[model samples]
Target: MNITLPGKAATLMASQRERAEKQRARLGVEARSWYRISNAASDDEAEVMIYDEVGGWFGCTADDMIAELRQITAPRMRVRINSPGGSVFEGIAIANALRAHPASVTVQVDAVAASIASVIAMAGDRIEMAPNSMLMIHDASGLCMGNAADMEEMAELLDLISDNIADAYAARAGGTREQWRERMRAETWYLPEDAVENGLADEAVQAPKAGNAPPAPEEDDEPDMARAWDLAAYGYQGPRRDEPKTEEQQPLTINIGAAVGEDFVEQLRALVRQEVKDRTVAPASDATPTGPVAETEPVEPAPEPAAVPEPEVPAAEPVDAWAADIAGLLTTPADDWAADLTHLIGPDTSSRAAAEA
Candidate 1:
């Protein structure tokens, strides 16, 4: 039977590397910390990280970072540091690995260590902070979210975090737990003297004065690129946006209102069609007539009353009647009569038989 041992080994190695990378991401954030490391030393007994400046993704030198760490063969680990802190959790992870080592660990700082760098400096058998340098410690922070229960749970998580950081400070520093809490609350910065007096730095070194002639530039000193993000708080809400969230891309209120109006109009039209269909589709139970059709002729039995009758009054005789009585003697009746003149005397009416010829 043939066994694919090499492939299996390769797969396992791949998985392990992937897990390491994932683990490294947990503490590296602007809202949190991202520690970069130059090298790590681990043997059967101990693990160590040597840091100059900061390490992790956003903080320090990355070239040969893994190789430098893996090269060490000491059973008891040593971490050499010179830094101004960049990422806190990355430093913590580095510290943790050393703690995990079976043998005691030692930290040797050539220069200054501040912020999280100070925290790392403390994770040692006897922290040997140079007198000319400093050690600074602050708070442990992370960003998270949830509902009621989730919020309480997150709160608990934060408490645990604060406890861990405080515990580290309390263990390594020459101060009470209350004093550590108060100092962190104030966001205090420490100088070399204060660091030493406070037990943050265990020793001192002499830094040379400036003004000596500088060395010539190296023939091969290409600038190293950086994996970078700005740090402002303990943690942030979510992943970093590559591009800014500009107003130009966001929908305006007017557009949102117009969309809602269009939806309402469509709904109204649909409702109208539905109602018309319902009206047209009458049920069999409603098909029967309610009554016979009513006659449309007007009712005329009560006719309007005749014009109001006037009160009785006598009529007066015409003035021409007397004249007609006198003219009757002189005139003979004619088949055709004309009133062209004053009759009884005028030739037009004077005895029409005489005038007729």
Candidate 2:
């Protein structure tokens, strides 16, 4: 299923995944949460102590237990458990392997059988609990991030998981699936007596050697009153954890440019038209007179239009000089009329006349 989570919710899911990975690592052999397999002195029964959480070791699994059983080939086997439960998947697998083994299996709860650990306890051919031990069962839980639809799907998935757990419990405990589900919902804690009374165990037994028992958590303080839905879902609530507060959503703001529309375009066109009209309008000083100017008492006469002068004709060149020059040219004739004309005209005409000559 696709899920679009907000940034904060995504970060929260990532942090939770990292924490689970770290826990899985810490529950390994290096952290001393191993399954110690040994044989009884007479070698009649194989003894296995599950001192750690389910699926706690990285290098070992249900296959390892089955492998151990294969090595012994004993007619009987003893499984001891003291765990707060870790991986439900691994626990269920181990339970099935034990139930299917050739040997008659005897399951002894040392300290606690909570979550999937309780489910594993039910695989015993004859279940026994220590006097001071406890057992708890509850619905399966998981982490998810998504929208409302995704959340609804997750809820349905959890219900399905819870049904599977109830089925496992009902197989050995002799109860209706619904009844077991109700007990799981309540996070029912069962003391050894309570477990026997509820048909969850066959009988009570003496506590194992002090050295073999599961150690109490260090704090040993009173339970915290805080609500722990996640841990409670898994049937393991030690000290309550405070729920982290979510950050508030800030208001979203955006700036968009002026909206475009036909009306806006019309308004823009009108504005451009107005600007063109303003520039095209003649100035008041150059405008034609529309009416007489307002006057009080004296009125100044309007100035006349400036007169345009007529073009002047050049006076006729003096007839006496022309006549004298003509008479001189006629009297000074040399070989031809062209020489007389050149002498009458001047040096420039004389040069042209000589070139022509």
Candidate 3:
């Protein structure tokens, strides 16, 4: 049945769809099969993948899926879904077919089951969702091309469809039809655990190991393809990929003594000492000249002066014995000065010398 949206909403959706079509065209994206069927672990078991939209836009229609299912003679069928949903009627038909199948049906939500796709999931005897997967429920919506009467009729039809869909949810999850309708109207999204807690899924399960998996199609090789769909156009604002995580860097450590030998360290210290001594001794070398230098006149010879008698030197003040000893020690060679000073003073002098060195 044709679904309907409000005038403004329908117009916006049409514009968005137009833009998406242009973008897909620019990207050279061609329509291809959105599902695959293959044998499972056992000969009597089969797996069906509905990994895109539900209808022909970028996926298979109900007739296509049902026909494929008819060919499987397995006693058990595993239906895996990862879709943003498509034609509501198509999805409902597929779901009904799965329910009518003689095989024990198991539904696995690989990533997402939104809109009509969630209805398709309800047909499973056992529904399992991947840990990071999601399920969404929303009121039926579509476009109608006509005047006020046609719009009104379309709106009424959409409400009926939505009510039926809500009833399907209520049947599975044990809620009142009206309660489910409220949630659908709000576009409820459920994470794996939430889906289980709300009875939408039986359990959240771990994905099968790669070793036990069947070879995937080349188109599905890129994991991001699931997240790459334009779910935004459907007003889905659920989880999505962010930037990839980078490996944490290890902390750095340095062993100075091991990196540079003791000899090298000593040499460095000696160079530092020499630098400090030079800076201390010639601090004025870095000063800027303040003014121009005056010209020097030639020195004139001084006239000889009469000699005067030298006054007798006053008796030298008696020097303290310790002062004499210190004076003598000051004359020692620079290499022995530390030792001499330590001898004159005490252990503290030796410590001071070592520290200065």
Model 1 scores a C-alpha lDDT of: 0.53
Root-mean-square deviation of candidate 1: 36.4
Query: Highest lDDT among the candidates is held by which one?
Result: 3
- RMSD (Cα, Å) of candidate 2? 35.3
Q: Across residues 1-357, which tens digit of lDDT does each residue of candidate 1 receive?
A: 001123243474355446545655654543222323322333343434344444443323322243344545555665667767654445576566556555556676756666667777777776665555556566555444446776566566555655566777888876677788778766677666676677776655556657897776686664434413533343655645787767886766433225545433333333333334555686778566777989898866987788998988655333245434544532433323322222211322236424532
Give per-residue CA lDDT, model 2, range 255-340, as digits (tens): 21134433333333333333445556887786677879787888699999899898996563343554455445444324465444
Q: Tell me the lDDT of model 1 at 140.
A: 51
TM-score of each: 0.39, 0.49, 0.50
* lDDT of the candidates, in the order given: 0.53, 0.70, 0.76
After superposition, candidate 1 runs with Cα above 4 Å error: 1-55, 58-71, 75-78, 83-90, 100-105, 110-112, 208-357
Per-residue lDDT value at 145 in model 2 = 73
Residues 27-67, model 3: lDDT tens digits: 56454667788866579889998988776454345676789
